[model samples]
Target: MSDHTINLNKAHFTISAPDIRKLPNDDGIEVAFAGRSNAGKSSALNTLTRQKSLARTSKTPGRTQLINVFEVEEGMRLVDLPGYGFAKVPLEMKKKWQKALGEYLEKRESLQGLVVLMDIRHPLKDLDHQLIEWAVESELPVLALLTKADKLSQGKASAQVLDVKKKLKPLGGDIKVYGFSSLKRTGFDQATQVISQWFSQNIENTEESDEVAE
Candidate 1:
């Protein structure tokens, strides 16, 4: 789909709900962005939508402590899940977040896919693997972005992309890993295309199910 078609530029914050029960009704397709704290998830969301403050970028890790929802269009939502794995977070609080995240990923009916972000220099940390595993178990599609690609040389970034892809093979779900730089806006189109495809696929599936029922 063309960039004009998604109209992500029109995207705007809908709400920030601390709990899943408080999120907008699970009536339509949505994609969740998940990553370790400080992995550039907010920066990526902002870049993809072409809205600087659509998702808040903070110098402090784990600043986004709630589930943030943005409207991509009617019935289409982009969810920014709270980042995990900040060192200063209490173990008890971290466990709560983890449980909540796992439940959200596994049980949220409207969640169509996930965008997993990882720092280019620190790809596939323990929590990152856990997130990917959750997606795999849920049978959700994933687009893994190696964020901060601009910090590395072109050759190094390309190699990291390949290495990340290779490492992800073991988890084995519908996953596509790409080198992405929020600063340079590199891989913006490609990342958005994957998200757009997830929306399209969900629509198609819903239609097919309706036809079968009829």
Candidate 2:
């Protein structure tokens, strides 16, 4: 297990939501992780947050059934969303994941940013593009990530990043993209910087909310 507390002031398992509508509304900032199954979303999350089994990664696709939330601090939470486009899954199940993912992305008010993970070789598939479209349509900030970068050589990793960026251009330049690897611990600092940027924005929003409450 990764001990995130060493660098992160606070991190803890929170709760799970069947849908965004069901998410607790105490008004905390939320950062969400979403991707296709086997894209290493969970692994990257666990690695970044230093939580070994936080999101539950497995070879089995569509394992996550709910929006798993983690309280990273008193005022912020991390949401692990169900993976989309698991062709091996049953129709009913595929529908469920789609619903869960859609509802969360569209309705989760506290959701401040999204971390979209993709395998290095397959950075932006159809599912990935749909998720990006959802974020853009919903006016959500997204940090697009290519996972499993270690599987590629350094030269290949750079190429993958370029490929991803090229695909993202149609989506707009407002979104940020990067490559990550849990095994090699590559892109940790870059990923951290992205999260920290969101944290600052979240803090600003929280402060404003607090002042209004006063």
Candidate 3:
């Protein structure tokens, strides 16, 4: 069976602090969403899953401060990670967030793919490049979503897509991107397809026993 066919449901929540002894267990292929704060990360998540409050939307950036894990189905998890690039937070807290998030992204073995959300009007910024670099360095495939496409005119959106493409080519091959608007329910199918393909292929590759053995 494919991920598209898999029945997705809510799983659980977690808040990992610097002193926290451990993060959640990475047992299955976990697809994560990461973006800068207030970049429509939560909205896009709600849009993709057809759940209004599946992820909490915040007017302020950096509100999601946890390694929130939602089990998409029996064999996979959808991880909503804390957004990056919120510098107004305290310096000490920033350091802790960086350490915690960076460690999770780097060390999580079941993390199969990353869905990087970028605001359509403001794509390819410094923070975006940094996270893209992290995904590439980890050898993880990224599916870039240019959210809030409704804000831009069609012509402008087309141009922005090209611009993002130019920036992503250097990261690695096979990166997928789409113009999405959570409010208007646009691009849901495309994003769902991306997740479906990612999880399905990953589930096929390594067995559960093999993962445990490793």
Candidate 4:
């Protein structure tokens, strides 16, 4: 039961590890962001942290090949996983990135939440569905962000969000769907609130565990 607040704006770059072995000691709460190559994951991250270039946006869709870590504070981190479902990359290279992503997702003890970004116009691709399903199966909370929402009209965007929600409703897990626009800050408040709550909930859980041990 601590009163401290989580501030994503204070996030700072820590490391970009090619593999999970190179990541910091797995002792803290980490919320990971995962998406397709053209899903605007970097832009969404930059918006979340209120930094112009915090996550390194690129003209090339699959440029982010490593697992980038940022620290919001000690024991609280945000991870940017390698983009998936990019058709332009070499088959061998794509396999490697997928391997890294799978390893991180399966083995990372600190992962508390997952933020899955997909283009509003073309969401829930095969890989995206697989990732979200896996997260739900693992009982992990998820925030499904339909990125580039500004590209669509308000009515269309709202319809898209509802459609996604309806499709994922059967999973029966802790999942949320929202339309997000990094360029216009759409869903920014809801996104931040959900992510902050995840961190806070993890902190409370850790505290309870410590008390029980004592």
1-214 per-residue lDDT for model 1 (tens digits): 2222566677899998777888899888899999999899999999999888899898888888888999988888899998998888888878777777777787789999999999999999998988888889889899999999999999999999999888889888899999999899888989989998887777777777888999
List, residue by residue over 1-214, the lDDT tens digit for candidate 4: 8766999999999999999999999998999999999999999999999999999999999998999999999999999999999999999999999999999999999999999999999999989999999999998999999999999999999999999999999988999999999999999999999999999999999999999999
Comparing 2 and 4 by TM-score, which wins? Answer: 4
Taking the tens digit of each residue's C-alpha lDDT, what string does model 2 give over 30-115? 88899887788888888887778877888887788788888877767878888887778889978887888887777667888889
Give the 10-residue window scoring lowest on summed lDDT in candidate 4: 1-10
- Ranking, TM-score, top scorer first: 4, 1, 2, 3
Model 4 accuracy (lDDT, Cα): 0.97
Instruction: List the candidates' TM-scores in order.
Output: 0.93, 0.89, 0.87, 0.99
Candidate 1: segments with Cα more than 4 A from true spot: 1-4
Candidate 2 residues lying further than 4 Å off, grouped into runs, are 1-9, 209-214
Which regions of candidate 3 deviate over 4 angstroms? 1-4, 9-21, 207-214
Can you tell me which runs of candidate 4 are displaced by over 4 Å? none
Best by lDDT: 4
**Pairs with backbone N, CA or C atoms under 3 Å apart (clashes), candidate 1:** none
Give the backbone clash total of model 3: 0
